[model samples]
Target: MATEKWVFMVTAQTPTNIAVIKYWGKRDEVRILPVNDSISVTLDPDHLCTVTTVAVSPAFDRDRMWLNGKEISLSGSRYQNCLREIRGRAGDVEDMEKGIKIRKKDWEKLNLHIASHNNFPTAAGLASSAAGFACLVFSLAKLMNVDEDPSHLSAIARQGSGSACRSLFGGFVKWTMGSKEDGSDSVAVQLADEKHWDDLVIIIAVVSSRQKETSSTSGMRESVETSLLLQHRAKEVVPKRILQMEEAIKNRDFASFTQLTCTDSNQFHAVCLDTSPPIFYMNDTSHRIISLVEKWNRSEGTPQVKF
Candidate 1:
């Protein structure tokens, strides 16, 4: 191949998101489509984010990836799906300085080497997969010159992680659980920019950095199968809460925001408890923190912080 010695690369950083209205159950597991709309706040990338570098070379023999300096397999369906979706949208690229040209059709034949690093700890309930997948899609899109906008690319990211779609944008984002079967319309949209509610300070207290025993995916599946509350929350509670949360975010109503956030979080855990095995995500420390926050809010006659 003429480009044997040439390597083309792109680097991107994406911030993690905290779901105020959590996405607990999935309607379509293969596509990672949620049963209801969920809203989240994208944290500042400087503090919590993932940095990914994607490189394509004709000299490489196969697609490979490394996470946090350790080599990892790209054989998983999530990785394969993201890669296929991105490559399908790739456009022609010509770098005059490097004397390298990659045609749109050539993307399928090329192999990629991806290295990703997260600023925060993984599996610590930190949404590392959200930032990691968002970064992977964003960086690959840049390298391959994908013409899609952020919202369009978010659909691709959604296949990697349900919450990942929200990380594509800054500030408040909502993942619309579109009615489409293909999930083409299920994408993330910005509710409000970062500056709109910049005054709301966020403080994260890490009670335990240990990985949770239950993953959100498996836990959600269990909830869907065993918990009747999951159905009620997804069908009735979430729709109303989503509308209220959207309004709160739009109007910058901290009181309403805090109320809705706390209520939704409580319901999410309630469903967890309703599960057959009863998944316990929050430890004693977590409960104490929630109690303290609730007491403080009551004493102040308004929400001072959201748990």
Candidate 2:
């Protein structure tokens, strides 16, 4: 063991993702294999993201973490999964200036101190978990010298949060629901880089709600348990939509893109309604917003009109 006590760290930023084609249910919870393909837009990292700094030092006694300057538990399975995966792939590190050196074997015994900060408010209900977990995996990979590409690391991030896999790449992303039982192909891929469709302006309405009566996770599970429509959707509907959405993104077809996005979102919520105790994610306010958009579109008499 080299007698270097100096600390080494890596900082990285990862953006949140919003699924245009949504990831609703999982086939394998532990492996996080999706039942259907999902497409998402990697939001601007500057707007909503997590910035994480991961440091490894022999001085540390155990793995510790802090989020938004507040010390938090690292006992969560998500965090542990990411930490364990990255540590297993850790490589030797040498810093001539700081006179610090870390061997591949040393990483197994060393504890890491991780600190993360999110740009947006956690209360916003925007997928902060996606950004947080992506940032964690990304920063640790940098520190560990992981050789896998972003898509490979994305498979690891998927275990943290279903949506997080999309954030491993920039611009539009797609999480392919592969057929393999081992989930080797269940990874995110870039649909198009950010520059491909710069004209796209996404607006997020911070709707007021007194906590969703049914969370998307539980609601989807209920749908899978009871709804025949959901089964049909996973088996029949999504595969075609995934192909169309890919084409829309590739050709910058806003008309096809908007239609598919709106329809898919509605179908997902509709599946919730098919459950025994229906989930009402969209309130009167949500309905009113939809009506407003509908009326405006009808007045325009063109499907391709933009907001």
Q: Identify the leading candidate in terms of lDDT.
A: 1
What count of clashes does model 1 give? Answer: 0
Candidate 2: what lDDT? Answer: 0.85
What TM-score, to 2 decimals, does candidate 1 have?
A: 0.98
Candidate 1 residue-wise lDDT at 168 = 95
Candidate 2 lDDT tens digits, 1-307: 4665768899999999888887888898778888899999988888878999999888899999999999999897878888888888888888888887788998999899999998776634578888988999999999988889999999889888878889999899999988899888999999799999998888777676255566656776787788888888999999999999999999999889999999998988888788868777677777888888888889888664332
Clash pairs (backbone) in predicted model 1 = none
Worst 10 residues of 2 by lDDT: 208-217
Each prediction's whole-model lDDT (CA):
0.93, 0.85
lDDT of 1 by residue, 1-307 (tens): 2545889899999999999999999989999999899999999999999999999998889999999999999999999999999999999999988889889999999999999999888988999999999999999999999999999999999999989999999999999999999999999999999999888877778889888999988999999999999998888888899899999898999888988888889998999999989999899999999899888888998677768
> In order, how many clashes per candidate?
0, 0
* lDDT against true structure, model 1: 0.93
Stretches of candidate 1 exceeding 4 Å from the true structure: none
Alpha-carbon RMSD to native, per candidate: 1.1, 2.0
